[model samples]
Target: MNEDERVELVRLLPPPARPELSADRHRLLRGHLMSELREQPVRVRRGRPGRVVVPALAGGLALALVLTGGGSASGPDRSQAPQATQAPQAQPSAGSAPLNAAPVAAVRLLNQAADAADRAQDTTPRGDQFVYVKSVQTYPSTDEATGEATKGTPQNREIWRSVDGSRWGLLVMDGQRRPTGQDLKDPHARPDEPAPHPLGGGWLEPTPGNTGPSGYAYAAALPTDPDQLLAKLKADTKGQGPGPDQEAFATIGDILREQLVPSPVRAALYRAAARIPGVTVVDEVTDAVGRQGVAVARLDSGGVVETQWIFDRSSFEFLGERTVAVKDDGSWRKGEVTGQTTILGRAVVDQVGDRP
Candidate 1:
């Protein structure tokens, strides 16, 4: 079939009653889509015959669902995961300006954060336990037609992750419970085997791996020494994002926000972050929840956006993180808050819906 005919055929398939795709099939389709679009830039806008336009925030949620292997449970047989009380959203600020290239201050602050992490009272979770995290986040959305940027509303998000990478996890957002991963009754099922979804549909059992960024198993297995951890981060995330240092910093932030890590590993992550070039100290910044704090930040390759990890000024505890536009990049204005998050709580829970 010609390329256009193939694309049309794929698009003509009826949408599945339940939104479930096996990991292998999902990867195959994604690769095919990329190959088809390799020579043509796809503009995501309205009224295009062959284009699909997704709202930015909804797209973010969809990505989260895919990564966690969770979406809306469709069948009556599916159980609802327990919902946590939703916290109030705080008004987002414009964020602070980068004062100077204070590497000394940044390194000192990271070391302090690392020290605090080492002294933290953290309990090791068993294989069957789940790691629960609560947070509020906001990301920027752009009008595809006008290319105008606007900040998204702060959203409360909760997630439950499998402790040992063997069980299904859960994500709660907008009052909906989405379970992740296939419920594999046969422990010996291979990645190529078809596993029935708890709701309805066949999903390929995901291969066991330490590559999932949010998996506690992966986090716990990280090198505890700062230098080795940094090197590992670079190696694993090579060729991702705009640059290596930025990608490593962002990966560490992702792990910190979601997974429950051992104290030593957590310390190592922070110390490793300190060694990344272009990282600086921002004296003051506010998280999505409006708590003011200091930050360790790095600018993107274009030097237009600065991603900051906010911390409690007095306690050196991590509050959350934010991304501010450092330069006007046509669509975004300088000092605009592009994205932000405030971590409310994290713990090792007994079940998918249980609170700590």
Candidate 2:
């Protein structure tokens, strides 16, 4: 199938719920299968009256569903998942009563971000192009026994991804060049030692994996209707992680940060997030990069850490993500900063390693 048709068809198919597997193993399987699909000859044919269609690859899709833990073709049975809690809306701010209800300030902010996304003039990238993102990442240290905060370094990060998922990508950290490999191999590689952390940072080529129904094509294919989008995300993450709410929130964050989802989809994603239970606003917060913004956060069950997504207060642009210690664990204190990522820039580029 051609790119446009392929994207549309894939979008229509609901993403599979995440399966139980090591993250690395999952990526490997997805990458391999997706590559295989790409190899099949593209066939153009007549459609009924005024439409063109591509036949679904049942086997490939089924395999993807199974491997990704997306459940069956009928979609994930969310009956077993925990239901979302109803959150109180916030009071409206300033003079904008019509759209600034406090109970839903978080939602309103997201809506604004969505509107900004809709109005954004973005380039339609080519298959061989790349999506370049620059960010600053920080990892805070803590004393395991007392949960006390310790010293940490913030690393400058640059990432480039092949727009078509060819697996050609590059990562640069703090001006240091990581070793380039085809997949998630060790960044500190040698001719002899090879395996690296699956989620570790390094130069990468196409590996045998996919991040469920993530990446550009998957994001573009997402439903734009808020309710439908929320349902899709809930279904995609059902029974997958700590809980549906937390996992769903995380999935949305990944889509925002990791993929080049269309503006409409991005807006839908933000709106869908507003529907999840327990997501409340943190009026002001700082990201790892130290820029301040309003935050929407979700606390995990144990209350050890709260994931906060920070955004510009006025513009509603996404600023970064942060993890705050809500309660003292052995390694962290309450209110301690655990990790942060400040997004600096994102843009479409002509080639891998090209700066936006």
Candidate 3:
């Protein structure tokens, strides 16, 4: 493969140090690969950490590598070829199937999420308690020299909100800079360091925006039926964008990502999403925090980006949300990650600025 193809292939591998891999993903990939090998007269061999070797086969040839981005394991040096090995053919049971063979329906995934949410300890916070959340996000930027897409340093943001909105909220954010290596050091270069925002937190008044508890409470009280919930979403999002359906779809993600709704309401939200046209499921996806999960996405006709919400495959717990450019529109490159947010922590605390 050429240099550009190698880079693109590396991007397709799963991250090596994914600590938050859901059980379902593990099972699905394992079963799928095993079933595929069982049907072929090929021998599989393991290489260095994160590298898998599958000999050239008759029907088709496929390779799967789980490794860190831009690492040696991800970018294999193909200057030399390996010896071939013969393996015995075995039969895979009916239960062994690729995730694509029998994918979970969108409605089923939504109900599964609802069940998990129902089991969660989502306590209604007291008026004085602050709803606290911590997240890390990285925005994409273009390299001035190569014009390749790159990510800026991950910024950590902490927010605290009064449950009743009677008092003010607090927000703290920090940014960091990448270090210039010693070999390529420039006169103006400095060590990799954090450039935190001002020591004090930004104060916020209760409002109807996604940053406040009002939106959370509103989502919590939304009707649980899919039809009613979708109607409400459509009605609220009308005139906000070019297409009401796309706006409604975007609004659902906003509400889920920014609010802490009740279990039934959360289920209703997912189910309502399934009713939207163009909704589709991706068997695998990764979050900004290196967590892996399944995702549900829809093409937003009103915008140039596709909004995707990710969840743990087994428990169906929310992991993060992201937006990718559908086509190059000069503002962003095609397939670029325009926005991403990974939730690190969330809880209810008794005082402002208190982290959970």
Candidate 3 per-residue lDDT, tens place, 75-132, comes to: 4454332323449757567955333221224434555666677677767877667778
- In order, the Cα lDDT scores of the candidates are 0.71, 0.68, 0.63
Q: Name the regions of candidate 3 deviating beyond 4 angstroms.
A: 1-104, 140-152, 175-199, 208-214
| Model 2 per-residue lDDT tens digits across residues 1-356 | 89888767766765544446667767776666644543443232344321122344443364555465653345556563443455996765885323212224455456667777777776777777777888888887677998777757899888877777765576778767455543436565444333443434565555323345546766777899988988888888788988888888998888787556778888888878887887766665777656777778888877789888888866678888888888768667888878887889988888656665
Candidate 2 global TM-score: 0.62
RMSD of 1: 26.9
Stretches of model 1 off by over 4 angstroms after superposition = 1-101, 142-149, 177-207
Model 1, poorest ten-residue lDDT window? 47-56
Error of 2 at 31 (Å): 42
Give all candidate RMSDs, comma-separated: 26.9, 21.5, 21.4
For all candidates, the clash counts are 1, 24, 1
**Ranking 2 against 3 by TM-score, winner:** 2
